[model samples]
Target: MSAARGGLVATLAAVLLVTGAGCGGPDEPGGGTITLPPLPSTERTTAAAPAAAVYRLSGNLCEKADQTPFADLYPREDAKRLVATEKLCMTRRTSAEKSVSLTIDADLLPTEAAAKLFVETGRRLAKRPFTDVDGAGADAYWDGDQDDVKLTSYHGNLVLEVRAAVNVKDGMPDDVVQRLVRVAEGTYAKLAP
Candidate 1:
């Protein structure tokens, strides 16, 4: 072959070699021309799905609840109300002097998914003014309107609702809000822990 033709052939061979090397497969950024082999069946072809976290609460809602937080606030009188549809219980405490009452409702649902959805919906539907609560459960909010204030919390599969009602005619304490916050934190520690 002539010298010019030989030079062109050499350049073409070099380009073909580079292109072939690039076509081996893509794990490279821009991708590759050839398909990769399938991963072994015993080995995970792709990342396995993560397991759902297990959170469970068992037994009586009333008997197992912690109410010592209310010892200073009211006279302890616990209650249990089981409807055909759900498990509901309350610990009602009354302030002897101010005609104040606080009720803690621990409602256990069938699954964590349901309780989470309930709390999510409840938080969205809240129209009254409320404070966002942390460390109580998966999510919680405290709201007060007129004579009644409520703290709704969700943990595991349990939906906890704490309601406080005071008689405005009788009197209201200045530190009631702070005290309720303390009471809520104390109550959640016992229940969730």
Candidate 2:
């Protein structure tokens, strides 16, 4: 494996470890409060809505990839390779020539505060500086370097993220990144308030 890919994998692993560590035992002191860094925002979000009225996953998240819009954005080889869970939809492509993966996460939080905290924490954990993503969502940012791009957005009580990982020899394309962000944003909009 390339040094860059190895380093990226390690960095991502560290991020996951740190994020996972946020959880604590039921009796742990002050563990109920998720320890997240403050977001660089001054405005406050509105009060929480009823759980039934709030943003929640709808339909099959992975099925969106089968649509023409999504199919046209990705390589034909990756067209039908989506695997989705309650909170994530992922597509992977691997051939003798190249290998790449795209994953979209629909982060469902207990409250709007938790969602904002999650998004901000992800931005802080990026290996590279994050650039604000305009026209995507509220306080969106593109994290990670050129080889992989992690587009994150804050919408309602959801922190949507789309991560694209490509081989170092063939860096991720700008168009691909934009299209993936658009897809994620569209999906988020469709599923949330």
Please give, for residues 59-139, the per-residue lDDT of candidate 2 as tens digits. Answer: 566654322333443444566756767677787755555666878777778777777888777755555655666766666
What tens digits encode model 1's per-residue C-alpha lDDT throughout 163-189?
A: 767677755455555555565566556
Model 2 error, position 70 (Å): 5.7
Which 10-residue span in candidate 1 carries the lowest summed lDDT? 78-87
Best by lDDT: 2
Runs in model 1 lying further than 4 Å from the true structure:
1-60, 75-86, 172-193
Leading candidate by TM-score: 2
lDDT of each: 0.59, 0.65
Give all TM-scores, in the order shown.
0.54, 0.60
TM-score of 2: 0.60
**Prediction-by-prediction clash tally:** 0, 0
RMSD of each: 18.7, 14.7
The Cα error of candidate 1 at residue 15, in Å, is 45
Candidate 2, residue 63: lDDT: 59
Steric clash count of candidate 1: 0
